[model samples]
Target: MEVSVNQDNFSILECFSSPTRIRIIELLNERPMNIRSLSEALDIKPPIVTRHIQMLEQAGIVASELIAGKRGQQKLCSLKLEQMVLNFRSQIHNKKPSVQKYDVMIPVGMYADYEVKPSCGLASEHSMLGMCDDPRYFADPVHRDARVVWFSSGFIEYRIPNYMLYNEQASSLEVSLEICSETPCSSSHLQPSDIVFSFNGIDVAVWTFPGKIGKGTAIFTPQWWHKDIQHGVMKHIRVNEQGTFIDGVLVSNMTIDALSLCADEEIVMRISSRSDAKRCGGVTLFGSGFGNYNQDIHCTITCK
Candidate 1:
């Protein structure tokens, strides 16, 4: 589930190295079970099962919760992931690039400015931030931990450091995020929306995303996240001397120079669904640890 396992993390590696733990994962994949059930199924002692479960939980491979049972409350264990990806890039040597670069990942809920309408709300992996269609919740302190946000109209803005662009001939500025078209909370059918993106108030590009994105489970989506909408596709938007592009295809003539980025200046990224657009189905932004792409607002500047 977009797991980035660094080779240096011996503790996590050791957790997976155990055959008993591996068997535990396989058992949980079938279905969530309690300590007693797991012990019986795996023929392990209760204490050993508890110990392995604790280790798996610490390694983020499993999650447990207490639930009402006939005997009282029982701890239920489940697999937290369907797959794991090992990243070995840091272990390999590569040639350095010629350009200087800087990057930052801003969380989805950390909006510098926002104006949203009803049908707007946020949620964490475990629970909804507040009541759906309640605007006041958007301003709640808990929003800082939101993993996803959606609105029928208006904009959400983020300010990123632009010092890397100051006085330097920037080769390219890239902004990448996971997004999808929004719909009525109860609707499961497809809707279309024209989502606009801007940098420093300069319109960059408008992308049309087809709705009904949650047809299947997202690789990283938590089991508890049962909603009509669940995930979004990763989209890459770039601005350079040539033009603005969405996923590598030029979509507009708006160049990076038009943004007038300066040293120590903060680049404002605004995402909105204008009222005059052909479609205003809505827009949803997925944050780190929530969507198929385990990333937030990724911004990078390459300077020559």
Candidate 2:
């Protein structure tokens, strides 16, 4: 899992603040070692080494397991993070003059309309909402608490409130959500699938998720979540005067003006799999209580 360095991660950062822990990470990078070996190599007391390991393990920087050894059961330690990047820019928030912004988060199961095929299912954090592949479950009242929703085909549509844009000109619009290609179970196959995003009947962008994602556990996924089924990635799709962007990188020439959005018009956001896609891996939407990023379908409109 990737995490940005910020105030929220101060505890994690503190784990790296110690020289002894830093050396331990370097030693573990070479190979997994027991507490005795680490103590000997670092020339530190065994108790001191154990204390450092506990802190590292709590911060998810290192992992330890007990195994039979020549003397007795020994704890094996290994590094979890292969790389770390520190960026100061993420902490800075820029404010613009005369800009009014409205933000809304749509829960995964609260779609205005939907049509799904087999292999579809919905689950809350605690348990499955209903029988898998049963389309009727989409309309179930209990779906409102759904944390994850997956389907083999079809689309899900949402109606975003546009009253905030009334009498104001929208300078830009952004829709961010966590999504991934769907499969029977987590597979390693990197099949190409075209996922389209449309706004107000205009095709804004068609992103191709490389494959079904599920090698490891998501950072925020609940403990009860099945290990075999993993969380999707967080993606940001933006439309502005400059053009359309996915995760801050331009992917299309479509601009906000082309949408022809009206001040009082309700915005229609639709996500669908292209019928002509070479591979139909399906789609999964993650909500606030699920996935690596604990967020729902977030929509932000910046007006001037």
Backbone clash numbers for all candidates listed: 0, 0
Q: Judged by lDDT against the true structure, how good is candidate 2?
A: 0.79
Residue runs of model 1 more than 4 Å from their true location after superposition:
1-98, 183-186
lDDT per residue as tens, model 2, 1-304: 2356787878788987999999999998665688999999999999999999999998888888776678889987866554455665663465634778888988988888888876788888888899888989999898888888877778888898885645788878889888887743334443557898999989888898887464476645677776455667667888999899887678999999998878778899999875567767778888877765567898988888
> Local distance difference test, per candidate?
0.80, 0.79
Worst 10 residues of 1 by lDDT: 1-10
lDDT at position 107, candidate 2: 91
The TM-score obtained by model 2 is 0.67
lDDT accuracy of residue 129 in candidate 2: 90
Q: Which ten residues in a row have the lowest lDDT in candidate 2?
A: 183-192
TM-scores for candidates 1 onward, in order:
0.67, 0.67
Q: Candidate 1 lDDT, tens digit per residue, 259-297?
A: 877777888999998767899877888887676666688
